[model samples]
Target: MTIRVVVADDQELVRSGFGMILEAQPDIEVVAEAGDGEAAVAAVREHAPDVALLDIRMPVLDGLAAARRICAGSRCKVVMLTTFDLDEYVYEALYAGASGFLLKDVRRDDLVHAVRVVAAGDALLAPAVTRRLVADLVRRRRAEAATEATPDRLAVLTAREVETLRMLARGLSNAEIATTLFVSEHTVKTHVSNVLGKLGLRDRVQAVICAYETGLVTPGAP
Candidate 1:
């Protein structure tokens, strides 16, 4: 299936550059391009693309708000674009239901791969970058007492499912989780799916957040 995408950014060069890269792929199509958050949302509404690549700091709504609206109202997945790997808005974007994020300077292959991965309904949970970002945010939230502990929200998950969530929060991919539990990757996928379904999460990103919010995983822990 062709992966239809909308590339949104305030910079014309960045927007077109990404469009060019994605358009070069045989299975990927740049369905639309937007210069700001409002246009991004509108493009998603009209195009109904498989994925929307939105810059995090767009004017007239911002990517976070656009992501929330798109993810809430449409089946389209969102991948936030940022200038920094550890952008401060990472947590908010994820909570806004973005499937993942990409740096503005992402390599051609990595950019294409990110869209494909997210289009396939997987979150871009890079252990190195994502884990540190999530952990840092969780720690800050805890310090400010802004994060109300709600570990009981995980009560609906089975013990094994809960274990799976913990591993997910640790940034382990499906295969990694499988190896850890001595189970097949298929079984790991099943548990991950069950964890998301039972917890009412949209994807692994939300599942990871849930695990942390529920105290199933702690920051700075292995």
Candidate 2:
């Protein structure tokens, strides 16, 4: 299946460069290009692309706001782009339902791989980056009463599934979780799927956020 994508950025060079890189892939197609947030959302609606690559600081709407709208209204997945790996922006983007993010200077192969990862209905945030983003979000809310992961909600998960989620929240990939649990990667994938379904999460990114928000895992806690 071809993964249709929309590349949105204020910079003409960035837009063109990404389009060129992505279109070079056999399974990936650059369906549209947008210069700002509003056009990005519009392009997604029109093209119904599998993924939307948006610059975090676009004029008119910004990536966070665009991501919220796109995730809320369409089936398209969002990948935010930025020059900085700032925790604040990443945290906000995750909460806004971004599947992941990419740096403006991303390598060609990495950029193509990110779109494929998200297009396959999986999250794509780097483990280290995700950890920092989660920690930042949790720290900002530390003063407020912690909201435990809903027990009734978690009740649907089997013990193995719960363990899978914990591993996922710890930033372990399916293969890593499989190695830790001494199971096949395919089995781990099944468990991860179960965890997402039971939690009603859109993807692994949301699952990780849910785990943190519900206090199933704590930032920097060993």
- lDDT winner among the candidates? 1
Assess candidate 2 and give its TM-score to the true structure: 0.91
| lDDT of model 1, residue 179 | 92
The residue-by-residue lDDT of candidate 1 on 59-177, one tens digit each, is: 99899999999999999999999989888888888878888888888889899999998998788887378777777766766677765454578889888998899988888888898
What's the CA RMSD for each of the models?
1.7, 2.1
TM-score (C-alpha, index-matched) for candidate 1: 0.93
Badly placed stretches (over 4 Å) of model 1 are 144-151
Q: Candidate 2, after superposition: displacement of residue 207 in Å? A: 1.0
Clashes of each: 0, 1
What candidate 2 gets wrong by more than 4 Å, as runs, is 146-153
Query: Model 2, residue 106: displacement in angstroms?
Result: 1.4
Give TM per candidate.
Answer: 0.93, 0.91
